[model samples]
Target chain A: MRVVLVAGTTATAKIPEISAAGADPTLVGHTPSADAEIIEYGDTVRSPVTPVSPTGCPTPAAITRAVRELTGFDVLTVDAGLAKPTAAPTIDVGARPGRDIREPEPVPTAPGAFEAARRMGLALPEDELVIGETVPGGTTTALAVFRALGETFPVSSSLPSNPTSLKEDVVAEALESAGLSPGDAAHKPKLATRYVGDPVLPVVAGLTVGALESGSDVTLGGGTQLLAASALARHAGAAGDLTLATTSYLADDVPELESAAAELDVDLVVTDPGFETTPLDRYAAGEAKEGAGMGGALMLADRMGVVDDVEAATLDVLSRLDPQAVDGVEDGP
Target chain B: MRVVLVAGTTATAKIPEISAAGADPTLVGHTPSADAEIIEYGDTVRSPVTPVSPTGCPTPAAITRAVRELTGFDVLTVDAGLAKPTAAPTIDVGARPGRDIREPEPVPTAPGAFEAARRMGLALPEDELVIGETVPGGTTTALAVFRALGETFPVSSSLPSNPTSLKEDVVAEALESAGLSPGDAAHKPKLATRYVGDPVLPVVAGLTVGALESGSDVTLGGGTQLLAASALARHAGAAGDLTLATTSYLADDVPELESAAAELDVDLVVTDPGFETTPLDRYAAGEAKEGAGMGGALMLADRMGVVDDVEAATLDVLSRLDPQAVDGVEDGP
Candidate 1:
């Protein structure tokens, strides 16, 4: 089976760590590597997705375009966007349907990605189709997505470095701004995500639904990815191969991720040398903790036995800026 | 509010990282410096605890000693240890006492640690105890502990580093050995821990009870520690100040930790990293992902904003290898 690692900013950061984890470098790419091919989706812009308010969700069209450009796989975009001004329900109902609106729109990203897969004679039938994401402030979006889907858990921003109250304050502010109060409602998966959430969650949820419908073994990459995947699984009422790939940093950043996984009924896999590995030299020296998503993904890829020679792969990718070079490299497992 | 950092072997490995995180070297010794104070708890000569079975329950004495040494506070041991092995129950009961019973006993190592705090006139009229633990294979133990506590969720090892099948096999084997079938019973906290469990959990449960009885503010250090704390809060029928200190890694390691915190009926404070910091490294490299008790405590101290320098506090404790030096250091906030 030809493995397609959907590279994002987060995954790209982990190129070196992924290589160290034993993955074939030929199959990975951040910008453009001399090894594995790079998939550059037109819509996949590296914008400052952080500091996003609950007012807007990501442009679905852009996401669709990006998926098409990167994977060349048939992408389905579910219309799972939340209402701009979310309403806080006063009454509590156990697992009520549509209690939290903002149902996802059933739209697929460009059919190009999927069509390209077909054109390349790639057989995805019954094969594992791993889906990962890179949504800054994704956890907040996850909280909103779950809330809209009827989950009641309090979702908040986590301090990426130390998992301290400073991070919790950001999460709490986001949640409050979104009209969700911690510990007020009985936390369910869908409800939590919808009330205080982000855009990528619905995207992942839609993708998970599509993957399951196709009967493909799916691995959801990152903690936010898994949260969306788990919510989708619960909503669809089906169970198949769905695994969560994340770094140890999430364990501390949002201790609630594990419980969310349990509620969503999914499996979890911890990526190695997560936040801990990024030499604290900067943060300990009063430098702000930097390089979280990328560092974590790289570390995760390495720990999962996915790649070898993390630094080399990272350096290789960093050294090259050509997309074609990324596509033509033959580093294999 | 004096800041006292507890040092462990893992911290020694991350000295440069710790130093980089703003710790002052001059303050890290038995003697208190201008900014902070230090407490050196050398790694005990306790035998290395391993996961005997997939159940991953640690020896009670080992966990107790570690906790006792780490936190020089009162020890509260739960009386749920089984005298002999019992077969897993086949039926599920929701929230019934004695339905899950495989809890372990708490063992105290430093008899004077708790008393010394009182002698030093540090006892608060309000309980000011903070609980921490050092149990190997704690996440696995958490799964068992949850099961033993009657949590019906399908608990698996938080080992993404290994093959998916291998983790499943271990979880399945452990369940089988315990004579319990997956999903056979409604998952509860106590039952889960008992059947597929570890010792740190019950000890944590006891600590929660201790905190409640003492009416003190409690912080559960580490992901597993938080998990146990949440479970204890749920089962013990107490509501007080209970905080969780963990790393971002745990959020990725297992989402269940997040889920459990949400289930908590008490005040929940999860100290994660602030979003300002980008590219947060997961856990520092070369250390076990599970042994984060001391690190979490340090972060918690930092988050309180009471300590001027975490690095200095840690070093001050490290420098005070001699017990006499520890006594001579002037305590500072």
Candidate 2:
């Protein structure tokens, strides 16, 4: 099956204090996203000066890259709001980084961003499009987008121990600054995103709308960020083919996601990467749940009957990411 | 031929007092460009409040729109930097309106714009592309781009009166603000565009590069603006089938265009548009000389063997624009 994987990075990822998206804070300085792209291009993402994040265990890019290798899908990287230039050739959206959500205009170019995203969406092949993103503090911004879109629910993060309270506090302040109440975001998604959402949200929303409007099957790849986009798409009166494909990690997150999917009438395609018994056991243990289009990429693999290859590659990638973890695991059949 | 017409409007057009783009200042305010799109869509451009510029006689949109009707070419409008949203379904590049060139960073998002335009260019059908534009005040910004690109040459304006002195003044101030000398622009096209060029230049250049790289014959429609784009494409290492298509209106304003074309080793495709003895006499009279991708649209019509239809339609559109001028001309054969 022909599929296009879209990756976008946003600065909101850096603000989440204990983001499990990287091995450490220093590795979080745009390296993870950049490394993710390099890995997807089948290149060793190692730089002497840059501390590359281990893709296998904590970040979704490594897993997504493995999925690409297993599934052999076409990938396109988009710099929706990357603070730094990436290592690979990326379709730069030319959007600025989102300011701290506390500001009233975190993404001042939100409307224009939709236009850019729509253009990208229109440019794609007329096949099912799997849209993914790799913003470091994406979950926080996802939560903000969700809340801004009037979804009053908590979201999962890269941290094994989700910082639900901190995220809630951040979203509250952002909503307040935007002069929005609980249900206000649904009415003006563009304005809400401009005031509080990260750069990727509006873009993803636009991509979804553009693809759907043009009659293509679209799977929003990620967890709540896509959910926010799904909400925006529905709010924008989009009546196209759309599904939310994610990992079982998010399916287990349940509650908010289930209600959101039901409300939006979006089909769900969740996959179990079977990382529990492998070296990448942390994902089963609930660390680094989803990013870099991992969920959708894995779903495509599962659909193509290459889930076993995906699982093996995930372990191999994890081995490269964390050599010490290799000693801890037994060989698989 | 399946062709796409990319039109970008810049706020810079509003600055020129006597633009060759329109007969009056009020007509210049986005109407000329918008009318071009409307005519291309095969509709009358009459809005009492909007002061629609006569596309047939003055700007090329009327002429190009006529060509589209005769040949049924696929048209895609691009909003590279429109001051206002267009009436049609445009492939919005999500670019901001360009600030006056006097600013140090007039088109700040130029590099990102290349990425956007390149994506649009790459998405088009694998056929010869006749890309056109309809930005008002595009000439002054074109002059700035040419000068910034290190070319010591003059550019044509939409006004028959040729506001060369005024354009030179604006460009001088812009170049000074950008801290650039002659020949600096060739080395730094993006930087030069950012400092002084309008939003359309980089986009068109990117579109040209994208189409050329993808192994397609590309004809940059319009006059000096496209010349500036050609220079940027060459500087960016575009080694592909490229040609510059414009009207005799611009060819008559030759010298600088000829030198620039010769320097770029680009072929020139100049169509007389036969406005001399036609009801579009004012165009021959040099009132509103070129704009709205009229020149390229005419060339494409000529290439397709429909120049007569284009001319007849130009007169028809002109009559709709200014009925008083219709009484002065004989009926078409």
Candidate 3:
């Protein structure tokens, strides 16, 4: 059996404006909840707003749901930390929503969430495991963690124009707030996640460790966020078959992603899904690059010979979500 | 992989004195949590009290822990409902602690918890699943559910004197409080769980259904409580490879248990574990009949050729818990 775990976090509050994963800055907090709901139930179950980018491009949850419908892998939502409660039935790993990355203690509940998720992961029967995350402004937290861990990489974003300098500025303030230098968390890797990382990082890292211990081949199913998780896993003394799966959009946006995975001793699998030639080609044009396990779902679909089905299913979903989008044909991607 | 899921419930508050599963009434709610802790982490992590019967007999968790150590199956705790929080990492299914079974509405959160647990169960990889429970006063609720579903049998207790009449009276009151008559829930099994059953019953029943759907061999891992879960599954229109696993003590106490499983079209497996000749023979003597998946753990251990290791490890656990009991060497059990 193949399992996809989509986790939510709230540390995105620091750079919500820069994130286009939702319609508005306030709606960014609900992006993970909506993404999780969209995958688990085939549509947004409870949230008033649909999960989409600022220009009305669908979140990758729609694509993940499309692949899930085409294939048969199970999806489980993990409430790592989300501002709004999800309508889908979820595994609650964290006790509280995340604080801003610039706070003295951004994720005080991370250790507990990580341990709980680790326990759950350790018990999973051996199979294919995919860990994904949805924190609207998580790239900033990812950058903060990378800088704290003494790694150099500008994280990619869902927005068309990557806000590299803004993320760097946020990480600077976060390091100062947490009383840390750039390389402080290199030896003490947990300190990066404790002080500046989002709730999703620790949970994904812990699950990666435990899932590896269970002899299951794990796929870290996001962009730089998952790379940070791999770093944490390696630092925590866990070693096994670890594969980082993402999309071509992210690879094209951040050229250093491949080298980062290579430095962490993790393999990478990037799926194109032919979105560039399909109706959802804006994905190739960089409108919501990846979130909600999109890259991993497409990779699994590719292995199952159903990757060709994602485009039509995703188109049908978008049509139902907003009939006018498809009715106007070339008006919207 | 083989999985043991231990769940806690709080519906036994009204009949606490009749239950010997804990040292005191208040401590009963902690039994399942402590049992989960023992099996998951090898000891009770947080609760101040040790989970033992009134006569200082070790709870079945000690045996379950020993079985886990010998045969490396994983153990998970599900917080169905408990007054005090558990120290072990848990997948919290239910929202609130249970109310008295003899209330107008006993388990209002049953439906939500059932759905959440079902979602989780459906995602489990194909594996052997053992579902167990700890509810100090669960027998009454089980009897009530049995009566509501038109089955007749005296429920067994942890105490040597089975307290059949007291349990019967409690069930009668519970049925009256729920405004239900005998066989009222025959075609409406969920109603019985909602009105007359404890929190664990719905979660166990829901998990049973989804796990069965997931193509795993499912084992209900306690005595009559698990029987109630099986009945709920049958009434909920779920059918698959179902096995009712219990101890010889329960089989001897409830002569109709085998017939009840036969009527439910479920197979029954009773494990003896040779406790009569071991230092922990009090289990055979009915000091603590069965809970914490003891029978299922023993069955797994027997298959793995480690059933004989349980007695010695149980004795060691008991000795560490209360050294005076084992020092005299023949005074306790």
Number of the top DockQ candidate: 3
What would you estimate as the lDDT of candidate 3? 0.77
Q: lDDT (0-100) at residue B61 of candidate 2?
A: 59
Alpha carbon RMSD to native, model 3: 9.1
Considering every candidate listed, which one attains the maximal TM-score?
A: 3
Q: After aligning candidate 3 to the native by TM-score, how far in Å is the CA of A54 from where it should be?
A: 17
C-alpha displacement of A85 in model 2, angstroms? 1.5
- The fraction of reference interface contacts (C-alpha pairs within 8 A across chains A and B) present in each candidate is 0.00, 0.00, 0.00
RMSD (CA, Å), each prediction: 26.5, 10.8, 9.1
Q: Each model's TM-score?
A: 0.30, 0.51, 0.63
Q: Model 2 RMSD to the real structure?
A: 10.8
Q: Which is superior by TM-score, 1 or 2?
A: 2
Tens digits of per-residue lDDT for model 3, B10-101: 56554746688777776787777667666765656445566877777777887877887787675556778866655454566654677888
Tens-place lDDT digits, model 3, residues A167-286: 788889989999999878885555778899888888888888888988888998778878888888887788898999998888888788888889889999998888888778878888
Stretches of candidate 2 exceeding 4 Å from the true structure: A1-11, A16-18, A44-58, A316-333, B1-333
Question: What docking grade does candidate 3 earn?
Answer: incorrect
| lDDT per residue (tens digit) for residues B1-333 in model 1 | 111121111111112212111123222121111111111112111111111112221111222223323333222111122121111100011111112112221212112222222222122222454555433233444454445455533332223242334334444555666667654433343444445544335445544555555666666655554565466456645566676666445554556666666666433444433311221111222122333244344454455563234334333432323332222222211
Order candidates by DockQ, high to low: 3, 2, 1
lDDT for A290 (candidate 2): 75
Cα interface RMSD of each candidate? 26.0, 13.0, 9.0
List where candidate 3 sits over 4 angstroms from the true fold.
A1-8, A11-94, A99-139, A142-164, A171-197, A200-333, B14-16, B316-333
